[model samples]
Target: MTVYRIPAAYLHQIEQELDSDEKETMLFLCQDLVPDLPVPDVRKLLLALNAREMLTPVSLSELLYRMKRFDLLKKVLGIGRAAVEANLATCPQMVSKYRVLMTEINEDLDKDDLTSLVFLLMNDLGMSHVKMAKDKSFLSVITDLEKLDLVSPNRLDLLESCFLNIHRKDLAKKIQKYNWEAPVHPIGSSLKYVNTLQASFPKLSLADPPGIVNKGRLKNGACNFQTEQLRMAIPETGGALGQVSNKYRMQSQPLGVCLIIDCIGNDAGMVARTFKALRFEVRCHLFLNVDSMMRELYEVARLRQHKNYDCFVCVLVSRGDHQGIFCTDHIIPGFSLERLKSFFIGDRCPDLLGKPKLFFIQNYIEASNHQETPSLVEADGGLCTIPQVADILWSQSKVDASTLDRSPNSSSYYLTTLSELLMDPHKRTLPLLDILVELNHKVYEWNRTNPAEPHSLLLEHTLRKKLFLSGT
Candidate 1:
């Protein structure tokens, strides 16, 4: 016993409406029918037929033949000549074999068939492949099919996959041409100034004096005597001059000493020796760790009085690796601007905006091969006989002797040990601050006489002006 499905009461209602001779109702029902629908209720009703028993092949064929004649199937399926041609090109079996065998009788397709085709292309094949196909005609067909709601959700993933496979260079060019959105955070303006400084002073070569060693002890324990020796030799060595004297006198009073040690490890000893040589009464702090140094600096600055030791003479003992200083600035645990200020300038000093506290860094003071003559001319308006003076000016100016005639009183000196020491791989020396102090004193004495000729009349006038200005 086989059970058969019926079209139900709605189909009967539809049939009665169609048989009333309503042309529009008949046309709509005729176009709505398909090969898949076995029973035609309206036709069966009009013929007084037992639709279930009339399942014979001939009967079904005649019914479909009449339906096709009204052009109802073609209008309902919306299968035009162009659509049929496109379907035939990609899928010949739909019309050539399946349609003929599946249908009870040959029939023209309605809009339903076209709608089904569109849905099939969209859900089954995926849109990305259709878009990528070499045939433009297929793409146009797909575009039309999409209007009927054919494409599926998985099409987006297929499109992304296609884009990812593009050549790297092509992708890069496309990216370059594209306008990029600005980043949220831009670099600070201070970095530009720092970069300019780095560009201007690409390489700064400094020198250290000879006979100064890293041996924890000086051969002679006599600090005053050693200081005198440094002082005495400075003039003869071209370290003394009027310009040098004026420069030192103009520098603001020191706040504190900044100890910058290099990789050589003996900078502590160097600092101790230099401080002793200069007769500066201050305790030297040795920092193996950056945190301790920062803490000490702050603590000392916090003290209300006696903040004269604010100048830091960073003695970089090692050669070539300057990055350590940057690392120290970043990692040092305790650093305060207040401490730096108190240390460099005493509490009595006015805070001048944008003035960097003076720092005198001394390193690599070995004698150099370069030599220059002093530009010191005699009071009689003739050049001095000191060959070292000439050598100094020569070394400093890098100009030929012809240029020396312009500034007669200009005395210059090249470090005696600088040329050779710079080439030497192994050797430790004194801090630059000590050398500068010694040089300053020597220049003061030299300028008191000879080319500078410190006049009593000028001194008296200067003293009078200072006293008058102070209202004393």
Candidate 2:
């Protein structure tokens, strides 16, 4: 369970500043007071506002004043020194509208306690706090925070999704349409602090890795009795790292992640759906193309999820005129195989308990009679004693620099064969090894007859046992 770390005080500051009510008021003023403001200009204003502890009176005044200063007001509602110089008569109507809106809202909230007032607002909007409490629902947690004048829709999206999963579509709709009225972008908000804060968003980890520390090292007190403290920059433990136990296999239903990076062609969605239909919880990421940096991001993201899944699957569909594949941008060589696979190895990722890790790469190479040089079987570069997480690698073409036949509609041979094999009623319940063996046999026969356009299933299975499916 490795995760990104951030300061707790900084997070607390963000929570205190951007209360839901404050956000809603700002959005409304921008809509009603300064109508037709450019999206970017509005975003900039919202970001600038986030940095201040702005109360209703001051927030409304500053927003309007800035709109006038920034020259963002509509043609008819223009004002200030620039407006006067441009012959657009200073329209005091916008300022008057802002004052009236703020006065009305303040007067209304002043009539009752803020907590009770917001609870009633939720009811008026069809959210029953009582009903959510009856179900022990977490939405109650949200409304409780609302009473404290704090809420962020960015963090609430997860709770809303949970509600939707339980068939609470009514609540889901509320969250989805929750304009909170402000358009605060996380990545490039006009607020510099917010942009900086985004980089520190803490990962919701199950727990931290036990031996790892925030900073510094742990040393015996007896080493320096005079100095009661030991200060070290980074801990350098002098021992081999412990990997997740290989004997502790996951017995649950299989789950997987699918990555389809296609720069040249399409139809990966069809492949992804086929895997999803097999009941594996599938996550599909599509890129018009991928570079080395994008590829690194995928590996990091998958490593984080290693502890939660039974098996991990990745499908890399890219251009293959080169050795590895062309990521619409980079010429990723086949030599990067270990670099890609090393992310899941014992030394690198211990969270992936010795279950099965699979990779299916869909890239077509030119058909040739050229034979590749064989690897020298040195004892030093051989197998491991402890059987780690098994790896299953599948390639579209044979290793002899041969071209393969692919279906125009289906797109790739590996996917076509895999989908067909999974759908076979007789083969569905068979162990995965048997299925793959049959696939190899069938493909060999296909190439033996259709020599002109030969396509083979090149499998290098280091998996110790059957990764069999129970079948649909």
Candidate 3:
């Protein structure tokens, strides 16, 4: 007898209706069982569920119910809300209670709440992870924790402590509730308990139980290894859909200033022209040394010109090591990426406050043996105000240094592709997020064809709305 799975049309219909936040919420709830998913599309998520043999009609209904997507539940599953609740009451839930609790806590967290949480976890998560999480959702932070083996069903102590530190007593209570109702077993007993669960509910597919030897393998040959590193490489948007209201305001005449710092003096003209076509006033600074570059950035950040604009874009094309980008003097380590963005934060550039600050960094990395020694910048302890990194979109790409030896007229793959995409009349009307998704796909395709000199692009943002550069 063939087991029943959700129909492809039903998955397509459900995927169509989910907004960005709803898709992220579903991914959060499924993170434990289906951790480190590359993209947040509803269809791929459901397929993962099915692969684990957990995508039963009842489990799907429960997931939709948890998401409060009753319309999909009723329309696609032909299951009523009450019926789902009743079924959940009688049967075991495929998604773990811990994930559900985490999802609820995430839903309750606002921007300030997430900021406080990141600050609290700074020491534990380190500067790199903190920087990545600063502009992302709470679920992204939790996903990292899951990757590091820091959070689990039995590992609520650290999370609960963070919640309390953030002054979220109500969210803390949810964690406490999970701890109370969920069974606590010694690490050694996880396998036995998993076996017992399988025996009790054969269809129940739990994520790797804490302390299970295999870590992330299913009993039925399912490969659920959560590759967190590759998550950003793939496009998150998946594809376009009907227009939605959740986008950034980009209606200003001169959208904003496009400040291009081209160290090699080769790509600034092209990049400058691209943003200019999008209604931005372009400022190109070519071949600046460290001191001059810093001063120019400082002046740009304080310029009165920002007051007339709706957005700000900074393009940096240079050589770089792991710690920071190199200037004309490549022998010494130059400015850290964080330091570059610091000048335009709310405190320093109040005019650009609440406006989107977009940074596009394309750095060519020298061979490892010739790379500069990486050093910590903020090694000295000092009292300084930490900027809230909201309304900023950061896109960085690292390419092989050999690419720089190419024809001077030809720019780097990332900047060239970005300029082409922005200048494309067809894509100008699409939201920046959608264009980025396509860019990521194009880069992946390039990597597949030329494995020797591959490129990587990372998109991280705290923009609260969609960004359309249609020049309307």
TM-score of each: 0.20, 0.40, 0.45
For all candidates in order, the CA lDDT equals: 0.27, 0.42, 0.70
| Per-model C-alpha RMSD | 37.3, 17.8, 20.6
Question: If candidate 3 were superposed on the true structure by all CA atoms, what would the RMSD be?
Answer: 20.6
Estimate, for each residue in 254-274, the C-alpha lDDT of model 1 and write its tens digit: 333434443223344544454
Per-residue lDDT of 286 in model 1: 41
State the lDDT of candidate 3 residue by residue for 15-130, as single tens digits.
88999988988877766456546876677887776765667677778888989899888888889999988977875466667678777787789999899989988877889999
Q: Runs in model 3 with CA error above 4 Å?
A: 1-245, 369-388, 406-409
Error of 3 at 386 (Å): 12
Give the better candidate number (1 or 3) by TM-score: 3
Tell me which of candidates 1 and 3 scores higher on lDDT: 3
Model number with the top lDDT: 3
In model 1, what is the error at residue 229, expressed in angstroms? 50
Report lDDT (Cα) of residue 367, candidate 2.
Answer: 34
Per-prediction tally of clashes: 46, 1, 4
